[model samples]
Target chain A: MQKIEAVIQPSKLDAVKDALLEVGIEGMTILEARGHGRQKGHTEFYRGREYTVDLLPKIKLEMVVPDELVEKAVQAIVSSARTGKIGDGKIFLSKIDEAIRIRNDERGASAL
Target chain B: MQKIEAVIQPSKLDAVKDALLEVGIEGMTILEARGHGRQKGHTEFYRGREYTVDLLPKIKLEMVVPDELVEKAVQAIVSSARTGKIGDGKIFLSKIDEAIRIRNDERGASAL
Candidate 1:
């Protein structure tokens, strides 16, 4: 299985979620994260004071899928999460050794 | 400076939250992360599709702590997140070069 993680603009979450759900991928985890890319955060004005804000708010989505579906999932996320703007975020794919469902104690590809 | 991440049972979240709050660590990001172990993702029936789902639902908690408090945080998480069950999840500690808070631009220890 592959663990697909995407760090994206928080605002893009709903669209991404809908896209995934439409693909019959109903399960995913979302987190409010702070990170940066080549832009390395940015400057913002608050109360007339310019501050070098370095940690941009991001939403991270993690999904575990069979090796065959990895590309489909990644493409769904990339297309949904894209904003044609800076801080669109990035996606990462990692290998997973196993997966299990705690509710019923199921394991292997079945537990997912 | 430890990024303590716990892949745990979703039900354990409330208990873990109380524990962390008790320790004065209120900031954290929770992601629904799917993973497996020696147990792996298991099988289930959804309308008898009997199709294999390779992703198991897991909760992932990430926190940035001071070097001095790494042990304390880890211990708190380990104790709070433990279920003594097979899919209780795991914890990982990784080095972070820098962190920033976009709202205020606080960096490093302060941002965490």
Candidate 2:
């Protein structure tokens, strides 16, 4: 299965959730994250850079879905999370070896 | 590189973190999570199930490390986080194509 991790603006959570649910994704794990976006570098070590380092409050949405739904899920996130601004955030894709549900030891897709 | 995600008990955060640091992993992203574990299924649809649905507080630790560190990192997490109980949580392994530091656009291993 493909795991989709989307780091997005905090304000866009509800809209993104609605969009995902509309596309048939119901379960997801949401996390509050600090986004290392561009901020002013305060020390000499990073002073010369074109941009500074800053951490913005970001919402990370994670879910593992069947491989076939990867592209569709990505589109749903990007379209809903984009703000035409630099801090719109990013999405990372990866492959999951297996998934086991702790409740009943259910494995694979059924567990998901 | 591999992305190691451990959904562990909130109380084990400190110990798990120390374990990672001892193994040379310094950077990580932490998120607060709610874990769905066996609780009394309160609704009709889930009432007859062997277990119920309840959300427990969990801490999700995320980091991308060099391929060689995957095994060590997993061991560090599993060893420190296990409580010999059902809610100790689970660890997931995935392959990351690339990692980019948003602060300055540093990419790949350098970013990680």
Candidate 3:
């Protein structure tokens, strides 16, 4: 099985989720994160004062799918999350040795 | 080397951290999350109205560990996070091929 992790702009989360669902991908874990990347932080005004915020808010989506679905899932994310902007974010693919559903001891891809 | 991702109850965060530290695993990333599993969500009253909230708050801890320490690290987390209850959470292990520390371009396991 393979795990697809995509770090994306917060604003694009709903679209990405919908896109994945359209492709028949349902189960996923989402996390809130702060990302530091090529795009340097910018100054923003809050309460009439400017502050330099270095780490930008980001959303990370993680899912484990059967090997066959990896490519489709990645494409779904790319199409939905892209905004022609620098921080559109990144997708990472990795191999999962085993997956066990804590509830019923379901193992392997079925557990996913 | 393997990357250990643990989705655990928010209340167990501190104990899990201390357990990992005791086992010599230091660096880790923590994120806020919501989880849905066998332990179904319950209804809660808000503003004098009852609402069925399905997803529950969770904490996700992620770290890449050297191959030799995967077992030990998993043990630490299991021991610390387990509450003998329904939603104690789960751990996932995956293979990482090229971890790069964005700051200095460090690669491989060293970047972890």
For each of the candidates, give the backbone clash count: 16, 5, 0
Q: Which sections of candidate 3 miss by over 4 Å?
A: A36-54, B14-29, B36-55, B66-69, B72-88, B96-112
Model 1, range A1-112, lDDT digits (tens) per residue? 6678889876777788777766656556566677745644466333465435466666787766677878888888889988686667799987655454534444555655
Clashing residue pairs found in predicted model 3: none
Docking class of 3: acceptable
Off by over 4 Å in 2: A38-53, B1-4, B8-31, B34-56, B61-91, B95-112
Q: Assess chain B of each prediction and give its TM-score.
A: 0.81, 0.83, 0.84
**DockQ of every predicted complex:** 0.08, 0.20, 0.32
In order, the first chain's TM-score in every candidate is 0.85, 0.83, 0.87
Per-residue lDDT for A87 in model 3? Answer: 69
User: Model 3 lDDT vs. the true structure?
Assistant: 0.77
lDDT of each: 0.67, 0.73, 0.77
lDDT of 2 at B10: 79
> Candidate 2: deviation at residue A75, Å?
1.4
Q: Which is the leading candidate under lDDT?
A: 3
How good is model 2 by TM-score? 0.56
